[model samples]
Target: MMSKSTPLAALAFALSATTALAGDPVTYQLDWLPGGDKAPIYVCVDQGFCADAGLDVTIASGRGSSDAISRLAAGSSDIGMADIGALMAAKAQEGVGVTSVLSVFNKGPHAFYTVKDSGFDSVADVKGKKIATSPFTSSNVYLPLVLQDVGLTEADLELTKADAGALGPMLMTGQVDGIVAWMTDLSRYTGQGKDAGKEIIALPWSAAGLELYSAALNANDAFLAERPEVAARFVAAFKKSIEFCQTNPEEAAQSVVNMVPELEHGDVLGSLNDMLGLVFNDVTEEDGLGVFEPGRLAATWTRVAAAQGLDESAHGAEDFVTRSFQPGGEG
Candidate 1:
């Protein structure tokens, strides 16, 4: 009485039903090589938020911001973590699925460091002086525009390619007069051969009429459409993790050190504390953590487009964001 196709169809239905019951697996690629700098993500993973959300979230390290963006564009990553600069660049080229869901740094931390005795009172004073920088970062190019506003050009100084570590010595030892770095970076370098009376002039990027957020959450399109619920849960847990970090910084730092062990650049607690101060200050307490307002962040996208020559890039907050996964409305 039972037809062959009917039995086969029933079996297929049962198998499909079973698969649906299984949790969706996803991997999140970090914007940079994992370290204390990525403490919040570790906190999220260790706290079991990913598991609670029915997502087997596997967080892995990326070569750099660009590398992370590339992987996110390819759908190789379900949720990709990266800076707004890199994400905007990716959106320009491929019309990718990456959309911002969280803002890691509410304030930009970038500033140039100079010894107080150097007689540099402001960001504009380093004309004809030696400067150090890590190339390809938003700072490398944006600094030039910033300098132009103060009547200084790249030609006014000898620019050397360098990282945060090399920049300080280049200053203390007099290799470079000043370096484009961050305030938090200066704090880290204070004990490592930092001169006692060497007061620093902090050149905040925000003062130049430009406010930029450093890190953010970007997810692949396939994931957004097929698994919106999973995305929302992860964001929810990520917000809680941030809150936990803000309230319990010392514990958060220790937790991060436990999760990642390859960090050799500096003390785990120091970096974790410093990074937390930069991204997760108590300002997130009111509306909740990792909150990104579309209107507030649209300016950042515009800045990214202008810097990367994205003349043809679709430049709308809508193209790259869906707040349905965040708090308030579940974007």
Candidate 2:
């Protein structure tokens, strides 16, 4: 056996293995087509945050939370961009192992829309009236908790599931009376000329005792266990990306537009600027962006549990969220 060559041969083999481990690729599924709400993530990619984190991150459009969760739990996806509600739902239905790392949109963007002249002034006014919503959201789940605070309950209203993206027009036309969804950017739907003069009455989750997190960076348990250092890097870079977006809104908006051409005309900046007012909020500005609040997560889970018509007990509660990656994060 050649003497001097032996040492060098071993070193080359070791380096190859090290590089392979370091270069492990990871893919993340976005909850919808990329756009303003997903701006920071696209900005992160454009600005090389993921690369700096030693991750080759891929963002793709998602069918919905259930699909996103299914892929993530099945290991078809290494990471997912989803809301706490999705995570809670998957845990409730299948006992899947998923965890949320960073929250992109700190404020829950769900709300109900009623015609300005409907005479439905408050939550109580919704009583005995038809209200439309998607059962998949925290808004549907926590209606009771919030209505309780507003002096209303499930018995007070007739609930219905309005097809997604069809609610805005349905509300503006007075077909269903009221529609529940994001306090949609009026500019978004009206820009399409479908719902001109349509107004959305904003009922922020914070005010309604539904302070659960929305739009978080998530991954499954196995991925986290196998590569924690990699996970930490991703979390850190994502946090840095948020700071960059806040400091440079124009650049951030453009980055997201590039990721989704349809959003170029969606009034990204104006809408994001408004959503930012609701999302950046006081807690985010003070505690780094994307940081999770356990109390809020718990509150959201409670509503989700009530919505599914079952109360969770025992160890599975950990399935909702985890703080292991947050404490040392840049946030």
Candidate 3:
């Protein structure tokens, strides 16, 4: 007694389901507010790379890695971009079911910036100087290690907690002797200094022996387990976007500005070029972009374990990272 229309309705429903399944929905979270440093990701979305890969992508800005990781664990986002060190800390403390698939910034960007007139020629000179830093920044998290390496201690400097945005203006106005932030911020701060006719000097934490991995692409474990092909497509699309950014710097910056029109185009371009060195290096030159070298990752884990007070054997390097998704991504 079934009506003939029943079969037609069932066929229409099946076709709609197939269309929905064709493009998996993905929500991506960022480690911090949108900026030129995040151009590759914006490029991927604006250029329809993710859509072409059969992903319906939604991008969200993060306060920091802690916030991003928490969101991913809570199922708020399927994937995230965050600091690898922050990811390590989360995995060590809470055993969050999120792991990074691609390492974007091989070189850490933690550093201190001071006007040349501050006479802070090296990390040694930072002692007794007033420093402004946001507790959220990766620079502050590794400040102890950098201090230890430079033969100083937190007690040696006068630290002031401030908003990340306020730190730059504070430094430019001589409100603080130095500002602690990432090297990507260095160019922007330097540009701020130039506007005021003051030269800014960068004393990198790397110089103080606090090298570690920075930003990366991370996914919720369940998402990877259930829809790995979708995740792999995302990785592949992102890889292409990073390559685009490397070759077409101005266009990449413009793509980001296209998404975030509030940002100054020139500043975005300048900052994008400034941070390029951190993203592309010998490791990237040998193994393709977004691929991490085993040795370097091991070294980074040592720093992460020490920073988080986790035992090395308990949290070996492999426990937190994977290369299976990278496939032929190696250069």
- TM-score per prediction, in order, is 0.83, 0.80, 0.90
Per-residue lDDT of 201-263 in model 2, one digit per residue for the tens?
655546655666777778878988898887777777777777776788888888878877777
What's the alpha carbon RMSD for model 3?
3.1
Q: Report the C-alpha displacement of residue 317, candidate 2, in angstroms.
A: 5.1
So what's the TM-score on candidate 1? 0.83
Prediction 2 global C-alpha lDDT: 0.70
Tens digits of per-residue lDDT, candidate 3, 74-123, equal 88899979888888889988999999899888888888899896688888
Winning candidate number (lDDT): 3
Clash numbers, per candidate: 7, 0, 1
Q: Cα lDDT for residue 86, model 2? A: 74
Q: Model 1 over residues 58-166: C-alpha lDDT tens digits?
A: 8777877778877887888888677777777777787666787777776666677777667766776778788888765557756766676677778888889976557
Per-model C-alpha lDDT, please? Answer: 0.70, 0.70, 0.85
